[model samples]
Target: MKLFGSYTSPFVRHCRIALLEGQAQGTLECEFIETDIVSSGKLSPTKKVPFLTDTLYDEKNKAEEVELTDSASILMYIREQSGLTFFSSANDYNLFCNVNTVLDAAVNLFFLELKDNILPTEGSYLERHSERVLSALQYFNQQEYPTQAPFSDGELRLACFLDWGLFRKRINIDGLDNLQALLKAARSYDIFAQTAPPEGA
Candidate 1:
């Protein structure tokens, strides 16, 4: 399997953690392809990073084909293909969805700030985005996950998103206590430590 995306993207980092965990569990073998999303013309369809390709086999003909595009779709495809449905359980699935929503909001805020070189003129709407991000962080800070396992898909994704957000200095979120604990737990893992996003990414 091939996973394509940039190192700095929180979305891509989420997928990368999943891939690494899957590999450690012997569920899948993943090849990481770091692509330049801004310059890459191949990801035009989805216009995003973390595309995937897997070979599907036919029962009778014994043929193979490639599948591609979109991080969520690709992740689902990989989970199904590898029979690693732990992440797709109905209970965990809901958590994944909720956490991903928070991640999306945070990423949106980051990009909006980036749009004007991190300087917002008075009366700019960027404050609204910042408000949303802080609200989400506050929400997360008050809740506890069902498990503290390092490899739980929801936990992994959440951890990756939080750290990547911090690395970019997009939002301080310093008061989010639960989030800070989760990040500390994530950092304790050697895999995550080694896979930290590149400097200035």
Candidate 2:
């Protein structure tokens, strides 16, 4: 199996963490290929990072290769294939949705700031995006989240998104104690420490 994506992307990082955790449990093994989005255009219909290609063996010993495009889909596929429990319950699934909201808003703001040269403070559209980012963070911070060794997909993605948003200066997380504590706890895991986004990103 092979995974493709940039090191700085939280979406990609979440998948990497899942694979890492799976491997730690002796359930998964694969290679990660760091590919630039522009250069990876030919790799998938979405032309995005975190693309996956897996070779599967059938009952008859026939080899079949499968491709996955979306990060969520890729993660789900990894969990199913490896029998690794990525989500512990419906609440975990709900938390994943909440964290995903933050990621989506932050990503839009990130691209708007970087690619379109639009700052959040400069327009209502961008400002709304910032509002969504803060709302999600504030709500998540207040929740009594469960602690999972190797981190649940929601926990992993939340910490990665917070770090990335902070690094990019896309959102301000003032007085978010729970969120801060979550990040600190997540770092205790080697997967998060090793898969952290590059410095100066």
Give the range of the ten consecutive residues with the poorest summed lDDT in model 1: 117-126
Each model's C-alpha lDDT? 0.70, 0.81
Candidate 1 lDDT by residue in tens digits, 1-201: 888888887777767766766677676777888788574466647677778776766878676867667666776666666567646477567667776876776676666567755643343565665666667778667777532455567677777778887898766766677788888877878777767898876
Which regions in candidate 1 have their CA more than 4 angstroms from the true location? 39-41, 86-91, 115-125, 146-148
Best by TM-score: 2
Q: Which window of 10 residues has the lowest lDDT sum in candidate 2?
A: 143-152
Candidate 1 lDDT score at position 101: 75
TM-score of decoy 2: 0.91
lDDT of 2 at 63: 97
Question: Native-vs-model 1 lDDT?
Answer: 0.70
Off by over 4 Å in 2: 146-148
Residue 66's lDDT in candidate 2: 88
TM-score of each: 0.82, 0.91
How well is each residue in 91-159 modelled by candidate 2, as lDDT tens digits? 778888888876887887778777988888998877887888877888888865444355678777788
